[model samples]
Target: GYILFGPADSLTLFSGLLVLMLAPEFFQPLRLLAQHYHDRAAALGAAAELLDRLEDLPDKAVQKHENVRNADPGAGIVLDQVSAGFKPGQPVFSELFLTLESGSVTALTGPSGGGKSTLLHLLAGFLKPDQGEVRIFGLAPGEVRFGWLGQQPFLVHGTWADNLRLTTPDASDVAIETALRQLGLGGLIDERPEGINSPVSESGAGLSGGQGRRLSLARILVANYDLILMDEPTAGLDPDSEVYVIEALHKLAVQGKTLVFSTHQPALLTLADHILSVSGRGQVLDTSRGGGHYE
Candidate 1:
């Protein structure tokens, strides 16, 4: 307006247009600065919320005992007056007393959400009881190196040998082959061009769920752990895979390895020397002996 209205020689029309064009460019930095400040504020708010959440979390103290009880190989597992649950004052098991014999196959059978997995977790030492004591072979739970087979099999982006060696680092090639054969993975390994050295997945093809689980069991076989705990070992497995798993577990039991597994399958139940039915009401009934209760 100044260039158009003022004296003609004072400001040229071209200079006026140039200033108009550069005006937005001159303020672009300031606009961006404001936007950046807004973004920074948002980020800080989010970080503050995260920090608050972290602060609200309960602190977990590491449990240590100077005189740790030595593991007694013959003690098996004992749960005395135990109570546990995810929430305080709501226990899954209240004053539950149980004992499992060594060198025996025990099966836990019950409805879903009946605390089968919770009991396994207690044995695995993945969870702590709200009250009472849990001992595995006279030692505290999780103190001993026991075999654990969860529903999901753990595999890596490597050869079969690599996956098996994850738990048993010093395992020999012969032992690896033997373990694979034990779990009925021998043919799969043999099919690979490089045998055990071949990558687990070839041509973007990975093992099926059952085969993957078998591979995981093979690791337990190679490790030769005295106490093995499995959570629904045959759940979601194909028919053939289930057979392989059942056979492997049977072999383990015959070898006098203490095996505890959670299963509802009739075939698996037949393998158990003792069958305990866990109920949602926190009642554990020893169904093997014509309905006896364990308290």
Candidate 2:
């Protein structure tokens, strides 16, 4: 016997709980699928909406490609003894110094809830470090413009092209076309009813997780930035798309673009010229892949 308590809404909440609690003898596979497949399902919804947005945006000039380097295309990033934590009272990782230079892809891998994302957030200027300094191309985080793609692909509703053009409103048709072709999306563009102007629902509804991730990656590819920061770039992608995106990342690195992405898979990590693994407590794992070659 359960004692009923709280306001009118409480009983409804309790009833919902009863539905879950009463289903103990239900099929295990269904329950497992619901739990395990949630992220995958959500990824699909996100991907579809992203495609729609890509089709909707107006044509504009692709951002001008400016070659930059630490001395001058891709410069190295430097974090001098930086520390970060959720609150002022307590900090997780501290005194971390790392250099992820241009012409290489660095994977930020670590245990679950480790400060890898937090470290990225610090480097991206989304979160100010509590200590030390973060510099890009010898400029502070705020000075330089970089692109950021997170675990969940985020998009503005409307059309697919609109989302693509957001980073570069002035992108010419040729530039956009080239970008699409580079990512094997040229045919996709043609298949869509609106071409690049295809409509996307909010937060990428119709596309699969892989499609959304690729679309977001495509947007990042089009941006002219010194550093590209991606969190869990391959988390929700299909095998083919993940491989495509990973290879594309390598190509960008070869082209002298600095990339720092977080990954949980060793396969996806192999392309990384460098690997920086962070611990659950914010300590970075050593023995990172060496041979920093851009060519």
Candidate 3:
């Protein structure tokens, strides 16, 4: 049964001429646990105290000194002669070039491991290219503020509203409700004995995969950024939820917000204004090369 813990194990041989011999190795662990009971209890008490303090403390949010106006002239993203790869001898992407305008939806697609996520990470200013440049407007990648949603999103230990309000501090209750309703989370929130005030466990253990995905999407929706980049946005979604997400994305695109997302879903692909197809071998083939960059 210990094998269920994982692949690591150790076996010892104990032979007896008379017939049977079995070492009571298991009892050793129990004896040690008993000896350490007080210490463990103390540690647990300390942890409980620390968590109580954390709950009491104001969520330690970053100070919002600057205002986010509705009509801010955001910078455009430019990938100028960008080339990235793991090794000098072999490059996953080469001489890659694309520009994401201030208001458009760009869809990136390709076979598995085609460097789609890597490219997005590059554009998001996380990874530096081995060669060439990725610029956000006139500034380097770091100069701009963008909201990115990866395949898996991390949730905060609070109510669902906390996750949704990450982008706009002043987002109204009505606005949040509308977003959640569109994504089918309003009922779940209401059914919760806690309602919006319900305490969400750490990492959202109380939520299912679909619930987590919706919550993650809500977090992105609440945030109003110059550019929104989503990787595999609808991969784990159910059919109805996927439709809602696609509708929301389309609405955002129509609102003049820029979006760049990678997806394997056919419906998501159909929503794309432009597609960046990556070959299985790891190269970006842009159909928008004729001054018709990714949608």
Highest lDDT among the candidates is held by which one?
1
Tens digit of per-residue lDDT, candidate 3, span 1-295? 3545533344323233222333456467888888799789999999999998778345332221222222244556777777776667676767777766678687888877878887788878888888788876456665566778888767888777776776677888777877787778888878888666676765788787667877777777777676788999888877877887888888788888888999888788776667778774645666544534321
lDDT of 2 by residue, 134-246 (tens): 87777667556688888887778977767778888877667766776676667778888787778887668877777777777778777766588888888867787777887
For model 1, residues 101-148, the per-residue Cα lDDT tens digits are 888898999999998999999998999998899998888876776899
lDDT score at residue 162, model 3, on the 0-100 scale: 71
Q: Which stretches of candidate 2 lie over 4 Å from their true place?
A: 1-75, 289-295
Q: What is the C-alpha RMSD of each candidate to the true structure, in Å?
A: 10.6, 12.4, 10.0
lDDT accuracy of residue 105 in candidate 1: 90
Alpha-carbon lDDT, every model: 0.86, 0.74, 0.72
**Against the hidden reference, what TM-scores do the models get?**
0.75, 0.71, 0.71
Error at 109, model 2, angstroms: 1.2
**TM match of model 2 to true structure:** 0.71
Could you tell me the lDDT of residue 259 within candidate 3? Answer: 87
Model 1 spans with C-alpha error above 4 angstroms: 1-69, 201-205
